[model samples]
Target chain A: MTGNREQLLALRQATVSFQGFVAVDRLDFSVAAGELRCLIGPNGAGKSTTLDLICGKSRITSGEIIFRGEPIHTYREFRMARTGIGRKFQVPSVFRELTVMENLEIGCSREPGVWHNLFRFSGGADTERLERLALLVGLQDELSTQAAHLSHGQTQWLEIALILAQDPALILMDEPTAGMTAHETNMTAELFNRLRGQHTLIVVEHDMGFVRDIAETISVMHQGRLLAQGTADEISEDPGVREAYLGSGGIGHA
Target chain B: MSGKLTRQFLIYGAVCLCILLVPVVVDDAFLLNKYARYLVFGMLAIALSLSWGYAGILNLGQATTFGIGSYCMAMFLKLKTVPVHTGSEGLPDFMVWNNVTELPWIWVPFQSTTFSLLAGILLPALFAALLGWFIFGGRIAGVYAAIITLAVMVVANLIIIDQQSYTGGFNGITDLAEFSFLGIDFDAYSASTYYLVAASLTVTLFLALAVSRSKTGLILQAVRDQEERVRFFGYDVALYKTFVFALSAGIAGLAGMLYTIVMEFASPTFLGVPLSLSIVIWVAVGGRQSLIGAMLGAILVTGVQGALSESEAFLETWTLIMGGLFVLIVLLMPKGLAGAIEALVRRLPQAGNGRSARHTEPDHRPETHPNLGGTQ
Candidate 1:
């Protein structure tokens, strides 16, 4: 509520349910511009549901999501995405049959309609941006590789690059390092650090070390409700938090 | 991406050569006419590839669009059998035979081939739009969509067969005069029809290529691979599906117009399920995802049909062979005949890198697309 940058969202008493199964109960949360927030929880803790809510991928059962000071309850996923919100799913999301370059091109493409393959795209500026992004994602050497051929870690970075292509104000990434190796986890942590200030990243991760390395502030959720918010060291040692779940081996063994 | 380009071009060039060379050895007019028919089929296959191959739509009623296009041309041909601009009073002869006092309202547009041409293209497009909008907007765009579209073709065939009084019935529209364009006589069997069609094929291919290269092309390709991701990217997925469906319909209609002239007739049979199914095979056999491959597949399969129709050896089993061939392509070569050729090209070590590089960069760049940014 108190920052030089504006609040990107205002969610009041938000709840999400699927087939009468409530995933997120009545919750209140807000995200400010340039905030590096981490949403962490045990399995089925509704961390993903939160990202889905913010990005409009899933409609709220009952709540108000005032995005950028404007309520967008009726907007669909794409319209909300166009409002400068980008989402990267837990699984790497790219056109597998297409080349890496094609995958990136589609990511940056502003086309709102489906096109039949009756036309071909060629240009200089886009090629330049694609190359720049390729480098950013460490894919310069594999631009021609089909996305299907990418390694798990590389696919994660590619998804990140794809979200970046949208030039969004806030990127909602679900499990950015979910299936990565330790080396990949460390590298991604560094990459997130590099992306910290210029871009606002809301990374939903289970890897406490990765989260601890990248997140400026961490928010823990339990049973669809925020349990606590503090720096990594503060939350790890907090007696109330330890007694709540982590003390009983609830999540993140570390 | 470069590999994709080389694969596409090598196959396309080979197809072009084969098409140009076949007229040399085959001296029979009987055989040549069949080849011409196949060429028209090939055009429709290309249209299928444009939609299903590139855009990831399974259009089970392609023949409906083809029928609309062909029937339009047939109506014009039928009208020409009588005097020019003669209205219901003159009657195109069929009307008289049926003891009709007045011509049907739909027949009025056939007074001019241009109107019929536009109607032919627009009708199928409009139909596709309405059907696609309802189905896609409702978020039922898979096997269900194909089934509903197939139902359309069945209804269309039945309607054509039953409406003999106005439509010439099961026999369809036939006994046409020459197809003249701007005073140029284009009578059936004339070299003009072949030339006109051949030229149009080239032009249609070019236009299709341009579309595939356009910005809309990129988004549609994305949709084909990952519809949800495309939806998440601020695209109206239903509208995109509708656009591609309409585009495929229009292109199919264009091929139908040319086909009517080549066959010199249009029957309810033309609207049957086989015509639609055969087009799908053409695309699948040639390369489901490759446009030129789809056209090549159509031409090749239909050309085989022509040869078999005349040959004593494969008379009863030709249909089986064609069906088996499609199965083989789908099973053994998922990428189709084009993949086979691409393998051959890739085998050449010296010809690899440079060819791929040509198709690489253009695929990656994120730029403002033209015409295709309607949704963007």
Candidate 2:
């Protein structure tokens, strides 16, 4: 890791407990600006919980989350979004009834209040941005298509485009390529590679191939705690990563 | 977009033209007055559609707002009819009959026509805003919200029925003086009042259409389909819901004031569950998602009921037949009459804009190939 890169987000001793069952124990984690980090773990390893804590989806039991040097653990989900953090759910959640262009336009809305939304008309600048975003996500051809009609990979790309429409500083994606074909996965990897150094991302994924393709540093979580963190190559060879995540399939499998 | 708006305007204009021709075509004053009553009901249906169809809030207590508006207008009219000119106590007959010696502080505000009219609209909207804030602010939705609103209607009815002196009890405020504004008498029996109702309905319909076509309307539907997604996008879901709920309430209030003028009375029945449920039915039968369809649905259903009840053989079984029709509509055309019409329109060769036609379908699509995505 570089020594001088400014920290964009930090979760210091954050914990989440549901009905006396600890989902995420007190744990400290931080990411630098414009860093693309991957979170990998076995089932119930608390990777998603970490993302939830940062996005204010789950209330932290007792800890601090600092975003852009300001503590944000107490903010609501929508407030956190206004502070420039966007999240992509594991299931692609787009407005099924609206067109692809409408979805992007909503994402690009500067003020989404009742009065503003009622009178706000999409200007030429917004249309240009929508077209540019659609092209970037490879959905320019389907701009007028209803989101419900999009294929699984296309929906995933649309969700990505929606998050980018917010122009957020930090993005948390839960399995960005869970149902994509091999080719689609390769394309997603390329998209993420292009996004690197432009936006900070914390992606929770299980596909080792996908992870190795886009990730520089991989953090392995186990039993609600950080088990290991290193380069994909270094983590693949670590004994802790093998015992916790790789299991019987040794590093040779990758 | 302009084409869609033009089509909407043509339909609205046709409806208005028919309404304008009613007095000329129909020789019977009774039938013309009945049609005027239907127009008032149509406004209520449009209000319900704005909330239920567009904003996704199933407001089962809509009539409570209507009742409030009606009572406000009725009180003012009752006050005017009191014989203050003959050196008699300027109290309505109902207040005098109930042995009310002094004017209540609440009734004092209704002395001014302008105050009464503003109260008729603002009171209901304020109540709706407060109730919606408590309900939606808690993030409660769907069935629970419906149950809560239905409960409110029941409570409001009971309160009106219990407060005999103030609310006129079960009989409600009656024998209202003819509504007059700016020295213009709006005789309930004349064509002038009918035109007033028609004009109000037209304005309400246009206002609703404008709101529904705005970007806010798209977001409201999105919130209906995926509320959490909208919240995750940094929009206040509760605030939007409350705004639409209050807007719907205000419209219903206006309709209530019209009902008082058309019927020459306001009763506790206006606040009852039956009327509230009927409003929902009208919107459902019309096409919950279509503003114009809801208005037409109200008129069609009311007209059908009138015709059926007047027949000698079907007099006792009219309600049963209406119930069956509602069930049939729900089962056969879940999207209601408007949805059916929209489907028919889409099939026509000239129905060029696919975007406008798409609003007729169900907003929430069932997840396809659910097993394809890996669980988190």
Candidate 3:
């Protein structure tokens, strides 16, 4: 329930059908400004699909996605990205051939036109901001290293840093901590905690411990629809979530 | 870093110096003309490197742009020679021979040399932009992109050969009067012509370097590495691809014009599959990743082919020999001559401290410097 805070994004009965199979069905979801919302469910629960629909990667079969009071379901991916939404894929997707510095610079780029970048080179005011973002992601030392050469954990952080480079209004992350070591996962949790209250974030993660650490509110999806929405404790106690997530085994974590 | 940058600068300077001093070393007008044409080929190689190497768009029909540029310039020169030699109502000999009446509407603007010169570059650029837009905008990528481009080029070649009267057919446009501008004659064998080619090449190289070094160039490289990721970062990936494609075509067109000037003819062969594929081979052998390497690759392969043609023993088997050499190069050095040179440079002893020296090893990365970001 949003109090005085403005709703940053609202998905009104969003449905995405692949041929005849529905990946996301009438998924009504909304997040207030600066809210760090987590979406968790069993595999094929349409959690990632919701992020995809929100970011315009998957077309909405029926319904509307409103971001900052404007309908964005019909917008293209790049247009949605330019309109202050940043997405980090489930797998790390930094430009592998480029140096970390170059990667961060591109992330921080304000203008996205061919002509705007033609005459420009690295350095200037954005350099300071890029360096700061690198520091935030613990990639300050590896700025000169190519993304391909970075360690798995570092590469994941580089993607996060890349999203932060734009300082976007909303960040859509799909399993941000997947494949990360526990230590790296904890660090990522810390980073996500720090990022909240400045940027609205929707993280689709299965790492329950990591999720419990940073998630203020959690939304659970089952069979292509939102099954429950509440705090971690509230969701864990819900009988429906217990059946869908564990088939009566109940929430896996204490 | 400064030392490495300085070495790179000196290397580029040395290359330019060597090219400029070629006239002094070779006094024969005929030899100079051959070298000038080879340099034009070098420019074509640079164009390929930009699109294929940096942008990751492998255009199999690069000769389409080159041929278009060649025809544009050839049209003007044909008009000049038509009035002087054939004296046939100010119409190109091919058109007159075909028994057409007045000059076609297209030939009227070519009367002004400036229009022809500009059209030579602009037409190919415009054509590539539209083609690139269609290909990239459709999100057709990788091998499909290559196939589409190759198909378009073959179509272009067929069209040129099919229109016998308008395009001079398979024989091409020839027998041109010496091109003159500002009271200066540009004879194919003249040192002035060689300088013109040389100067044009130098300018082209630096302009390409400037582009490849720009922020857009870095972004293009990024787009090549990951297209979807770049899209999420708010870049119009198709536009960047189109931009580089057009730029590459413009350079190729310029090379085509220079080629026409030196060779004194325009042929359908210029747009044929062989020439287009040959351009790809040159870039592959030279080092697609390095512009200078690609240029040298073109010059080296072209020069060797020329020499082998003159030898009685190798005359018939030169294609075989070149083919074998190409296979060997691809097998032994997939990155081409430039990558080998770069690895060698990194292995050599450095004057700098151990930190900078350690940067050369492929597997090694410098230790994390926590204070590095804070210093600024």
Top lDDT hit: 3
lDDT of 1 at A229: 80
| DockQ (model 2, Cα) | 0.44
**For this target, which candidate reaches the highest TM-score against the unseen true structure?**
3
- Tens-digit lDDT track for model 1 on A1-254? 22677888778989999999888888787778888888886667788998888888888999888888888767987888887788899878888877677777777845444433234464435677877888987888777667888898988888888887777888888989888999989988988888887777788888888887898778878788877887888787766667557554844662
Candidate 3 segments whose C-alpha is farther than 4 A from its true place: A248-250, B1-4, B83-88, B350-356, B359-376
Off by over 4 Å in 1: A111-120, A237-240, A243-251, B1-32, B83-88, B97-99, B350-376
DockQ of each candidate relative to the true complex: 0.43, 0.44, 0.54
Q: What is each candidate's fraction of native interface contacts (fnat)?
A: 0.56, 0.56, 0.63
Q: Which tens-of-lDDT digit does each residue in A68-138 have in candidate 2?
A: 99998888788888888999999899988777877887687567688977875433346677678889999
TM-score of chain A of 2: 0.95
TM-score of chain B of 3: 0.92
Q: What is the C-alpha RMSD of each candidate to the true structure, in Å?
A: 4.4, 5.4, 3.6
Candidates' lDDT values, in order?
A: 0.77, 0.85, 0.86
Candidate 2 residue A224 C-alpha distance from true site, Å: 1.6
Interface RMSD of each: 6.6, 9.4, 6.5
For residues B11-72, could you state the per-residue lDDT of candidate 1 as single tens digits?
55565666655556676655566666777887898788878887888988999989988998
Counting only residues 3 or more apart in sequence or on different chains, how many pairs clash (N, Cα, C under 3 Å) in candidate 3? 0
